[model samples]
Target: MNAAPPLTPAQISFFHEEGYLIVPDVFAPADLEPLRQELHREIDRKARALKAEGRLENLHEELDFDRRLAAIYRDSKENGETIMRHLEGLRGGGFHAPEMFDVIASPKLLAKVGSLLGTGEIVASSVYRIRPKLPNIGRGVVPWHQDSGYFSTHCDKQLIITCWAPLVDATVENGCMQILPRTHRGEVAMHHTGGNAGFLVIKDENLPDDPRKAVTAACPRGGVVFMTNRTPHCSTPNYSDHIRWSMDLRYQSAEAPNNVGLWPESLDAAGKADDAFYEKGNVACYPPEADFLVQSRLHPEQVTNYAEYVRRRETYDRTQANFSAFRRWPESVATK
Candidate 1:
């Protein structure tokens, strides 16, 4: 792996000013190849298993990684969903592999992250997502909202950075993110439930800035688009012929409130954990997921390894914590 480079002073300045920064060379293109190949292999394994079980008609073996799931979906939504659920597009779903963990804990990626955050003691939120935006799919279309909209109100005042990296080149034609620049410094926009894909959305009138000023964020395979937690952004549909595969990871300063080192004494399939743990978990920005120390110069021994990360994630997956810290949005009442 190549050594991670730090962002220049000007680059950091632009990110703070514009609310989003697309750095196109944070990782060497080769650095992403391992994860991509592993994901493709995992898809093949899942598809074969489905076929053996008679859940799918075609394996879609001829198609490449970008088009395989789309082909499966074209044949059977059930089969596609099964494979997607295994790969996990949502938070705390499945898809835990060494390749995925390596990307998240990559020293190269962390250096750039540390530079933007202005701190070495970084807490990586388990809020990361594996997004596979398929061609012409309306379900992949994310509505306008800030990352903070999903977090507790107590965390809105803190700085949590989101790092979005595409597995393939993200283009406007392929549903790359659209960010509203210079609009992240204010209060979190009012978000409503029932946006496409069950995501929260900021209504036009509720947006912090005019939608016309939003910039199309096109990033390459090795690049990362860094945005603040309050940066208002949305994704468009993929009109292109391939999938727009990307991962959106989150990180924050260690001084900020987090649920690091917090685990349930016991958790069950019913989504229940220790009663006291529920209370303490509420201190995390997103209480449902487990946060871990990704980088800590103060205590390098405490950095979570792959085994521990997987255990923490899987353990947290079985838990559904009750949260009262974040303000809940009402269901969408719009007819249009």
Candidate 2:
């Protein structure tokens, strides 16, 4: 095991002041060998082919995040014989492989995230995304948006810190993420649906006239760009010859509110709780893999009344998707 590097005072001060920071050389490039091979094998076979064919489709439309959002399967044979197999173990009942958990639990990665977040007990596991950026593909751009833009707005605050980790080297040439520095101080910018990837983009009334004059954070693989949920950012296309594969992970304190509604359905199946409970709080819960801690920061009385929060969130999530409130981009802008 490598010795965990001390978080520099400068880095701490910068994150405190700027709402985001890029930590470079945090993980040894060579250390990612196993994941790199597995990721490339998966992307090269399935994701790469999809991009090549200009097909941006996701099978799991029923999922809140699945609309217009594309994903790669580690074990899908749909694109012909794939080399990878989904591990029997899963987190949150999602399709994550056990090896994916190994990467998240890596001592080096955990130590860095824990240090920044000020929590030792963290659930960095939930969603695993492989955004495939294929060579000469015009569809690679992720439109300018904030993460909380698409999520449930029922919580009192954003309780998430997202970590974007690239399996291959990410660069400006490959359309890595671009950020508007220090803008997280503003209100969570109002977002409706954007044409691309169901992204959360701010309306012209909510955006600065000259947002392009903002700074962009483009770093190498193994380094990470950490941001609050409200931070504004976007990525460009993969015009370069190489493919860009990356994963976006959300880490939350056990005490924060979540999307999963109250309790587990399996527990519901056992008749411990009723359907009403499921509709309210269980939806807020991360998939089973996150292993979220139920001890919340809310008053004990409020925590006990999770049904209220769950119901409110469900309504809020729907209201957010109402298209009439949004300024729709041209169909071309949405697709490309």
Candidate 3:
């Protein structure tokens, strides 16, 4: 594999000080084509299955990739909830598909990540998300929250990076990510479950004193934005007529202790045992899914393959019968 260009001294310093960085054109069109094809294939399969169940009247085959899902939802009297559900099936640690595995395991991408992490041993977190931001969909608009807010306190001190890359041009009108600069230097702000999607969001009172400092991270296809786990970021509603396709993948030091393959054990704010939160065989983390080793210098041969990735995911899916009952916060939390 060709060596990825290393980040400049200034770039590394900026990331440390500002909490996020945007690297443009990290992957070429040819590199992204496979993932794109896989996404479209998944969409087509879902559409067909929905049609077979008489949930959709038409497949919207005439629409282009950017507008097909939107068109399907717009035409369906059910207002696309079914379509959203199908897409949600592809979110969070949702890399069971071969195309997804290829994308995350891209050597070029991992090299860029390795530069920031200062290590070649990288553990790809199973907590990645594939976001297809459709126009005006509640779930498509992610609320402002730190990624660490959803994680167990056990991994608090570890450095886990989030790399968000768009498959299409992410513009202001298409709901590109907006981030508060330098927020990672601070503590994880208090968050509550609220917003149209009912996702976790930092309260307005906790927002940085200067809202003007927040900037929209718009970039072309294949450009990637890297952020620390504690950075405050969120995407706005997609006002455009098309779907804003993007993927958010995460990486952590392979040496960090995480609940990747093991069942999630609840921990208190101090990272100690919490009996109430512990379940006998529950998975860990929000949207608990299996993690895998993407890049490893110590044990390169042990890195997970496409088949192993699928097996771990399938095993979790089957064993996580009560996964939905898990909650990060109490029921008293207001979501409006």
Candidate with the greatest TM-score versus the true structure:
1
Q: How does each model score on TM-score?
A: 0.93, 0.66, 0.87
lDDT string for model 1 (38-79, tens) is 999999998999888888878878999999989998898788
lDDT against true structure, model 1: 0.86
Go through the candidates in order and give each one's C-alpha lDDT.
0.86, 0.53, 0.75
| Total residue pair clashes for candidate 1 | 0
> Which residue segments of model 1 deviate by more than 4 Å?
1-3, 89-93, 266-282, 321-324
Better model by lDDT: candidate 1 vs candidate 2: 1
- The digit string of per-residue lDDT tens for model 2 on 28-137 reads 87766676665434434444556567652443334222111222332233431121222111211322343454565566766666666676655443444555555444
Off by over 4 Å in 2: 1-3, 43-95, 259-263, 266-336
RMSD of each: 2.5, 10.0, 4.8
lDDT of 2 at 282: 41
Model 3 global lDDT (CA atoms, 0 to 1): 0.75
Model 3, 131-183: lDDT tens digits are 78888776688877888877765555568899999999999999999999987
**Candidate 2 similarity to native, TM-score:** 0.66
